[model samples]
Target: MHSMRLKDKIVVITGASSGIGAITAQMLSKRGAIPILIARSEDKLKETASGIQGRFGMYTCDVRDSARVEETFAEILHAYGRIDILLNNAGYGKFADFTEMPSEEFQDMMDVNYMGIVRCTKAVVPHMLERGSGQIVNVASMAGKIGSSRAVAYTASKHAVLGFTNALRQELRKSGVVISAVNPGPIATDFFKIADPTGTYVKNVAKMMMTPEHVSEQIIKTMEKSKEEMDLPGLAAFGIRLYGLFPRLADKLTYNVMNKK
Candidate 1:
């Protein structure tokens, strides 16, 4: 299939206040796409919009709030007439032992990481279906593909995201609405401050962290190419595939690698 051009495309990005979403909005704007930024921070959204060169819109809506998500999408549709792309990127993670973690924290992770994507996708998909041409990209994580120590809830939420994306893709196979997932490893962002408050995980994985710009670039390319999924960092992708084929052996190998100093 011929890749779609970015110029003049109406792109909606959730979690646009910071990290990958912010960088993606800037990049998309530079490529001549009209990026509509969404986040819970109205101030931060405005700040992001200020840096962009072309026309853009900012909406303050927490993705976990279905009513707010619906309203926000409705507003965007009223203003822009159509949505060409929807990037479901709003999510957070907490790294802790499952036994030590609180039930509330687990619920929060599921709400933001999994249901957030669900609400946003539900709101925007009908519009895409009506037009018969649109793109939906869910920002999942490598943890979704493989289990990791100290991230049970986080991993579970991401796993849910991957499953949801795959199922939706199959359901929309002939709907002209493309669906894809981007599974990135640790990113160099403030997310670590929230996920790993002690700074241990971030420091250990610092060397392997990819910049938000790098991930954003791949995501934009995926949007154009309509690739089914992407696992950032070639080594991580290899590990994930290996785990899929040989879970027992891969588990032992992963333990050894992760334990290496």
Candidate 2:
């Protein structure tokens, strides 16, 4: 149960307005970390900061906007002098068949989910490298590893995240900057409102959904040790391993069990 002593550490979190992002920020703040919140909505970022007792800052920066992201990081670094960690959690998903999905939706997914990580990481990596110490955690999803029915573009975006995280970790091999990925199964969040607008998918997976608190705790633990990668709930992680070992059987099971959602 050894964890990183987070007291007074500065953490930059994207998508900090709600769901896992908001919850994790609060938890870190409780542990005495200054959580720098970033989101597209200034009001929501304010709300998140309000719930935090420790010193915190908020910036409304959309991940899709690369220039804005760079400026935002510059401002944070100027104010704080250093950032101890970064949580790239700002992303959304739209569930639709590939043919029925709008072209813009696919592009948006790539921009926010994949390139967003790229833009934010590009902004922060040099600083971390220069300091010779830091961590970057990218919140990917189980869909990234095991593709499901209606989220083709979303799946591709997360897959890119995994690929980028793995490659960058190698590139930074002896640099002391740690990069990690978090792949979690479905969680109870407003994410479904956009990803499964009809509520059909949520209904199908109602019994299996994990709470934001549960996922946030696991994330905190990952941050504590600077773990290389994590897959949550144990069962889901086991399933992913089975998929790697038996693709044909896993594919059939995914179609029957997961695709229903």
Segments in model 2 whose C-alpha atoms lie over 4 Å from true places: 1-4
Q: Please tell me which predicted candidate would have the highest TM-score against the true structure.
A: 2
- Roughly what TM-score does model 1 have, to 2 decimal places? 0.96
The per-residue C-alpha lDDT of model 1 at residue 111 equals 96
Candidate maximizing lDDT: 2
| Candidate 1 residue 96 C-alpha distance from true site, Å | 0.8
The alpha-carbon lDDT assigned to residue 247 of candidate 2 equals 85
lDDT of 2 by residue, 1-261 (tens): 334488888999999999999999999988878999999999888888889997998999999898999999999999999999999999999898889999989999999999999999999999999999999999999988999888899999999999999999999979999999999988999998999989998888888899999999889888888898999777888899999999889999778677865
lDDT of every predicted structure (CA atoms): 0.90, 0.92
Q: How many backbone clashes does candidate 1 have?
A: 0
- Residue pairs that clash (backbone atoms under 3 angstroms), model 1: none
